[model samples]
Target: MSTSAGAYTYSMASNYNRVPKSKVVGISGSEVIELVKRRLLKTQLVKMFRLLQSLFQ
Candidate 1:
């Protein structure tokens, strides 16, 4: 085996907490909706702040 392959084998053997390849990670539907809401609110607040700054200047 090549040096890289041997290193990969050694690393895999040394790590016992690795996640399986078949298992997928993701957010739930409600979490995604909440994340989008928070993002939109943050953007709107930033735009309002910028407008106020321009008005005051």
Candidate 2:
């Protein structure tokens, strides 16, 4: 959903089905950004691990 200021907000459906949800981000007159999966934390952790490995190597 969007507000009067044009900022959009998204949420997941709380139903009996165990389906996953996605998030969307966009700017005015720009290409829309879509998050097909909810893996933000995992992605960050992977990145950090790679960085640490590189440093140790």
Write candidate 1's Cα lDDT for 1-57 as tens digits: 112223244334321243211212236865522221112345556877999999999
Question: Candidate 1: lDDT over CA atoms?
Answer: 0.39
Q: Pick the candidate with the highest lDDT.
A: 2
lDDT of 2 by residue, 1-57 (tens): 322122332343432343323345544676666544343556656877999999999
Return the TM-score for each candidate structure: 0.32, 0.37
TM-score of candidate 2 on Cα atoms, chains taken together: 0.37
> Evaluated with TM-score, which candidate comes out highest?
2
In model 1, pairs of residues that clash are none
Measured with C-alpha atoms, the lDDT of residue 5 in candidate 2 is 25
Give per-model CA RMSD. Answer: 17.2, 9.7
